[model samples]
Target: MSVFDTACGQVRGSGPDRGVVAVLGIPYAEPPFGADRFRAPRPRSPWAGIRDCADFGPVPPQSAQLPGAPSWSPGDEDVLSLNVWTPAAADGAAPGGPLPVLVWIHGGAYTFGSGAQPDFDGAALARAGLVVVTLNYRLGFEGFGHVPADGADPCPPNRGLLDQIAALTWVRRNIAAFGGAPGNVTVAGQSSGAASVACLMAMDSARGLFRRAIAHSAVGPCYSPELAGHLMEKVAAEAAVPATSAGLAAASPQTLVKASDAVVDAYRQNPHSGRHHWDPVLYGPVADGVHLRADPLAVLAGGAASGIDLLVCHTTQEYWLLDAVGSSAKVTTEEHLNRFAADFGLPDSLTQGYRGLMPEAPVGDVHLALYGDLMFGEYSSRLADAHARAGGRTFLSRFARQRGGSEPVAYAWHCADVPFAFGNLGEESIRFLIGGAPTAADHHLSARMTAAWVGFAATGEPGWEPLGASGGPVRTWDAADTTRAPAPGHWSDSGTVRTLWRSFGYRPLRP
Candidate 1:
């Protein structure tokens, strides 16, 4: 183990590289439980002696819905911690010469997921000459639920986001000892994590925390205050507790989690009823006009994210990973696609536009393609456009690599590109997602993806021209032949989908 001094205390980390070290489970904030429940995070108190930073810290209590999802459980409320990977020793100074930093935020629809998961190991990325850090934040009702707490201590909304800010603050003060330049940090994530990155950009509190940002398949970030209040009421009712911070603090985390799950389950069963204008997974950061005053996309369009270099990616078939929603087989006819579109107040003409784009694709495949756009593609494109229009440099790409045993799912479903980018495709948590065994081509593609990400983090140029507000340009990764060396191709956003996305209201989800 290698020992280093941080703001909080002395920490000893272990790593394989003689020159690389990893410090796991260092708290950035006091545990958000007991007296601290439902409150914004507070900085961790300093420790006296060398702290054993060997095993990962406890992750927040989470509810798992997928069969093979990574376990960040057996955990507790003392989970507002972070892990760091850096070179073992410095080149000149005690901490070492400054290195680029990559801070990853894990995604689980704002309710689940932890930074401690095996899928988020940063050793490989650390080996790529960067200080890699992953951190845990509050999730589900404890992190976000905004109840009316009349005559009680205030329960602030977006406690999870405040937790993230606290972690970043910890990094800024101490990462130099881990060989990272605070001014050169890049915040990145996938799915809801990506949405967090976007929301952070809009938050004035998050200003100057990081220099660059990368978001992968980011969904909507904020819920209407009415919706957030509604969900909190359901949770409060289910848990038989008053809708206030003092009442929730009296309840156990497991009880809150179960109550939250029941609320979402009911919404999923009948999503179209009443004010369920969005999907059940709509619980996230709320537009309380405080932490987040408005829609994040509108904020970005208004130049809230300006001056930060941005890179955003969306997989070709992101929605196909939704096994619960049935596969391409469910949508057999064009009429089916039209009916689905109508549910979201979209026009039947959108399906025709998609059909014209990929005429040879099967009808069900076309449906998957359309759903992909609705779920991830359209939002990502709008984010890119808004950032560019605000004069911020932006880069856009699509991951379309094929796999060996992916017959069950379509091309590059959600998160299929994560392991590749992190150069951890062999991780067991995502083995089922990776399909068959990793291939030589997979490794090669991974190398390129990592190189691009690292390059972006270091120099703010990802080996591509910055995409502007119009004339959309994209870099695509596809391996048509597994035996041959794969190369990324460039193309204009010539597809009609670009126009379609522009025409749509940029809503979170649709029919």
Candidate 2:
């Protein structure tokens, strides 16, 4: 066993090799239970002697949203812990070192997923010569549910975000013991986690915590105070309690979870009439003028992230995976497609534009394309555009390749690149997404992609040019081919999407 001292206390970790050393489940903050519940994250108290940190900690109580989404489990609220994977070396290396740190935040629409999941094991990236850290934060009602402070101890609105910031703060204080340079940190995540990264870049508290960021498929929006208040009341009603921290805090995690599920059920049953018609319940960061000062994308456009290098990417068929999770409806009739378009305040004529873009695709696939662009792809592209326009160094990528597919019309499904980026395609969580066994081509693509990510974390360059340069090239990655091209418009190559997003007040990502 190897032992290292951190600011909080000494921790015993597993033996190390030149390849990797792991120290798992070290608490970064105090348990958020009892009196601590519904409050901002507090520093974890120091321990005496060496504490064994070899096992993963319990994840936060999660609400069941989809089949694989995390759910309530029997555990205390001591979920704010982190796991670290670093290149093995002797103790007392230096005040600063050659290694760069990448802190990973997992995504589950901000409701499910844990940093300790097998899909996110950091050994591969650690073996490639970087320090990797993954952490868990409170989810659902315990994390983002806002109770009216109303002069009482204002229950912190963004406890989950506060937990993440606490973890990063821990890294900055103690990474040197693991041979990592606290000065060269990179924050990276996908989906909701990516949105968290975007939010962090705009946060004053997160300044100087990391020098670079990588956002993959970040589809997040700033929650307004009015929306958060309404959701809180809905959750409280389901729990049969008052809409305040003291009232809701007395409820068990399971009770809170059931309350959360009820709110979602109501939304799923009658979305337009649901209390939260525009926002997802008990998820996302709020623009409460406290933790987050403003809309994340607008802040980036205003140069809040100009000093931070950015690398953002997305899959070609992002919503295809949403279909895998039963999140999309099959468009069987022309009227169905028109209604779907109308829901976005878009012209029914936009359906023809989608069909024109993917002439060979079936109507259902086309519908998936439209939904994907609206929910995720467009946001990611526009974030890159905003960052680049603000003079931030930005590199955009399109993960357009996958295994086990013969037909090739944007087959790179959502969450597909994750395994490739981590160089762990054989993990069970990724098996369903990749279909059958992975091919030699898949392994090759994984290698190149992993190398690029590692390289980018080490330096600000990810083997691609900055966006909006000389034709605005976007580096496209596939198993058999990797090339660059002028911004490819939308994933579906539909002009309708561009116009629709513009109507929604988004500037174009493509030149």
Candidate 3:
């Protein structure tokens, strides 16, 4: 049946093509606008009749016009909604009982992304025996910007995170009606979304909402309260607000987006600007000591998220995507490279070691490699290592799939593994991300990736060994050897690359 019952009303989805039905634009929380703007999410009011949920809800306010995804228009207020894609069940009940659920939070550096993106379609995942959910929450300044306290009005920090928790709560109470088991849920994301997963694991309010997590290329060094306040000051200055809760609320979302854009442009134009000049991302989860107890790695290593299975993965060259997209700054000479090292507080020895490793590479190439590892690769690896060391069951892997010759975006890089895992390589909008049309090997690789995700969500057996006391094997996804799973990825991270970053930790970045 295409119609299903929910807590507030009934919803009729649009499909059963190959056994999958998607109920889109279901409100998990009330609209976070008007009287509710900048506050924690509240329950949506009960409706009178069935809501026609045939399309995605209005997206959070963002400037990014992603491929095959709608950008936020000025007057869209009902932004806190979610979508579900379930296998067609027998009379509103799955034939083989409820399936494990996977809730996805899309990533665009915490500013712009939607669950309705073409790459995140859940039909393949539903066919793989999963009840898939994707959601939209507040973004940019509306979600992550810091606002001052205003007594009873309750302008809370990290409203985006609260929206996510509200969505999960809705799933817990209503997923069973859509052929999903409430207790068997996996929360997964990439980049900023992955970092949100790490944050959720440490939150007391999010406890018991899900049993597993998959973080791919989790970004790090969350904003400290002071840093968040500082960034908001810049945003307010540009928006002509007074940097107070009341003042911030007075400005419109579209205006704040333009202000935030101005701040990023200023950073881009100045080469001598601080750490943010390299990659001027202005919004992320704030470790305010109330919502987030501490950094996620610290919380996970301290055994906060007990009995949770964790799986982590990262692409070999994560920064290449940013460089190719012109989002990253250029460092062309040795002097510029040395200055880059000092700007992020990296030691000269690290650059020396990298030069020694890649003797023939130019300064620009070396900068990209080092920056990529510093921002994503090393952080993700360390998270997995820390979680495993704390006696948590963890699995780690690397995506080394790359295409040679002259495709600029051909590297096995950031965001490349998502389509493969979601089994949506054939989507027209996904061609640029995958470097033009797909190959037979790419399709085969996508199946293998989806199978791995399915296996992990089902039984916690991801076809490889769990991390042992010291280290564990990593499953490699490569196009070169789709014929057979290559040699088990050994605990090779503890060697040269990791040694250089051994003393490093996630500190609040400065501008």
Candidate 4:
């Protein structure tokens, strides 16, 4: 074991053969409880003594309520904690060291997830000569719920995003102590984490904190303020409580979580409502003239962050992991496809285009593919294309390896790249998804992926061509070998899909 005294407090971490690892759970900001609840994060009060960080900190007060998923007890008062894995003490290494830093943000649709998940262990990445850090942030109602018309605070909701910003700030201040280059940081996340990275890219607060970013399965849209406010109103109504600051302050954490769950259930049941789901609260990260000045996609289209290097991509069969109506075996018909498309606001011509391409495929496949393209594939390409057109360095990729022997054969499903990215392929969670243990091929792929990630953090070059450069290609990590080629037509077909996203107010800049 090793220990370090950081600015916020004392942190204890585990060490490996390479060097000492110091995990810091310093509170970058105050707990968003009591009067401060439902408002933007405020700076944490500096502590007097060494605060022990030997164990993982408590997660935010959230629904201890997963129906069938495993559950664990919550922790200490400070739910905002960060875990770090480094090769050695920063002072021990040379100034402006060559070692890169990879800061990971776990994804749970901005609702649930912790950095302590076993699959996120950073030992392997540290062994590969990079520092790895993960953190916990407020979630669910505590992190995203909006205040009433007569709320006490002026900042718009997106407290969770604010927490992320605080974590990055922490990284900037003290990563050097862990033998990391403070200026050479890469922020990466999956799903909502990816969306958060997109938010960071557009957030003025996050500017200059990290030099590069990697967004896996990044969402193309964010909640509009009007939509988010309406959802908050509905949540308040469902809880049979007033939408006032006092009423919310008086509400219990459990009540807020349950109410938010009810809202999600209602939205799922009535997909035609045209309302933002629980994940993207229409009020989340508004163009509030502050935190997020504009929509992420819009900012990218306007050449914002053109100087930040980006590595963005999505998994193949992105929606296969979702237990929604479209992924079911029973929904393998044209009727089902049309219904799903209607719910997703996809055009008939687009549906027909998918059918024409995969004529012999199952209706369920076509249905999933249509929505998948609309939700992930197209948007991912547009992000790469947009950044490239703006003269930023960008590389795109697709995870194509299918976890063998699973019933549905998850084909690079949602979040499938996480374990591989962290080189935790043999962990139990990863084994369950990949069916048994990861083969030798999986280990090789993990090494390549980790190296690419660390390399990008070090020099903003991800071992691939820029999306709009002369080569304009992608590096595909497959079972056979790591290779590069021009992005295939299927991956680069951005025209029609770009139009669809633009309808949602996203303008894609083409090369």
Most accurate candidate by TM-score: 3
User: How many clashing pairs per prediction, in order?
Assistant: 3, 0, 0, 4
> What stretches of model 2 exceed 4 Å from their correct place?
64-72, 94-96, 271-282, 347-352, 406-411, 469-471, 486-500, 506-511
Flag the better candidate by TM-score, 1 or 2.
2
Task: List per-prediction Cα lDDT, in the order shown.
Answer: 0.77, 0.78, 0.86, 0.70
lDDT of 2 by residue, 61-92 (tens): 87553333244476666788899987775245
In terms of TM-score, how similar is model 1 to the real structure?
0.90
Pairwise TM-score winner, candidates 2 and 3: 3
- Candidate 1's C-alpha runs over 4 A off are 65-75, 91-96, 244-246, 271-278, 324-339, 355-364, 404-410, 480-494, 507-511
Q: What is the lDDT, from 0 to 100, of the residue 431 in candidate 1?
A: 72
lDDT per residue as tens, model 4, 419-463: 888888877765655556778888888888888887787787767
Best by lDDT: 3
Least lDDT summed over 10 consecutive residues: which range in candidate 1?
Answer: 483-492
TM per prediction: 0.90, 0.91, 0.96, 0.89
On a 0 to 100 scale, what is the lDDT of residue 197 in model 4?
86
User: Candidate 3: lDDT of 94?
Assistant: 71
TM-score of 3: 0.96
Give the Cα error of residue 382 in candidate 1, in Å.
Answer: 0.9
Candidate 3: the clashing residue pairs are none
- Using lDDT as the yardstick, the better of models 2 and 3 is 3
Q: How close is candidate 4 to the true structure, as a TM-score?
A: 0.89
RMSD, model 2, all Cα superposed? 3.7
